[model samples]
Target: MDVDTEINELGISNTVDEIHGAHRIGQFERLKTSHTGRETLKRLGYHLHDTMHATTHEIPDWISRALKAPIPKNMNPTLHYGRRLDRCLNI
Candidate 1:
C-alpha cells in the first residue's frame, strides 16, 4: 500500500484534522480583545507599549524593561502624533 493508504488505514488523517481544528479554535479565542489574549501575548514575551502617546508618566514598568532604548521622559505631542500617523499610512 502507498503512504496515503497507510495513513488512512491507521486513522492518522482524522487525528491530524482534529489537531488542526483544535489549534484553529485556540487561535481564534486568543485573537479576541480580552485579558486572555493580552495574558497569552505577555507570557510569550510581547509587552504592550503606548506608542501613540507622548507622555511618559503613565508608562508601565514592564514596557520600560521590554524596550531596548530608554523611554523618553517627555516628547512633543505633535511630533509623536505625526510619527504615529506616518507609521499607519505606510503600513
Candidate 2:
C-alpha cells in the first residue's frame, strides 16, 4: 500500500497529525508582556553568544563548566550561547 494508506490504516496509535498539530502560531511571541516576559526575550541581544564566539576555541571552558556550574544567570550574553541558537530562541 502507499504511505498515505498505511498512515490512514495503521497509524492510529502513533498520532503523527496530533504531534504536529500542537504548535500554535506566534508560539514564541505568545509570552505575555511582563517586565521579564516578551520584553526581556526581545531585549536579548545574544551578548553571551557573541562573547563565546569571540574566544579562541570552538567551545569555551566556562561553557564546559556550565555543565557542572549551571552558567550563572548574571553572566554577560555577548559571551554567546554556551549553545547553538539557544540564545535567539530561549535566551
Candidate 3:
C-alpha cells in the first residue's frame, strides 16, 4: 500500500471529523488498585462481547515485555499516547 493509503488505514487524518466532539482522554488517576483496574477493564470488556462479529481480539503479548524494558526519561507524548491507546484496545 502507498504511504497515503497506509496512513488512512491507521486512522490518521489531517483533521478530526467535525461530527465528533472533544476526544475523551482517560487518566489512570482513578484506577488506583487492581479492583479499580478491573473496574476500568469492565468498561472496555464489551469490545469483545460478540463472537459472531467475525473480528477477533488482537492481544499483543509483547506489551508487558516492551513496557518493562528501559527507556529514556524524555519520551515524545505523541508516541507514548499511541502505544498506550494501542495497549488499551487489547486489554
Best by TM-score: 1
Q: Which is superior by TM-score, 1 or 2?
A: 1
Task: Compute each candidate's TM-score over C-alphas.
Answer: 0.26, 0.21, 0.16
Would you list the C-alpha lDDT of every candidate in the order shown? 0.69, 0.52, 0.54
lDDT of 3 by residue, 25-81 (tens): 233323422455545656866232333233346668897557675666756566679
- Mind giving the per-residue lDDT tens digits that candidate 2 earns over 8-39? 78756546556555543244334332334544
TM-score of model 1 vs. true structure: 0.26
What TM-score, to 2 decimals, does candidate 3 have? 0.16
**lDDT, model 3:** 0.54
Decide which is better by lDDT, 1 or 2: 1
- What is the Å distance of residue 22 in model 3 from its true position? 9.9
Backbone N/Cα/C clashes per model: 0, 14, 0
- List model 1 lDDT by residue over 22-61, tens digit each: 9977875564446567666668776655442234377799
- Give the range of the ten consecutive residues with the poorest summed lDDT in model 1: 47-56
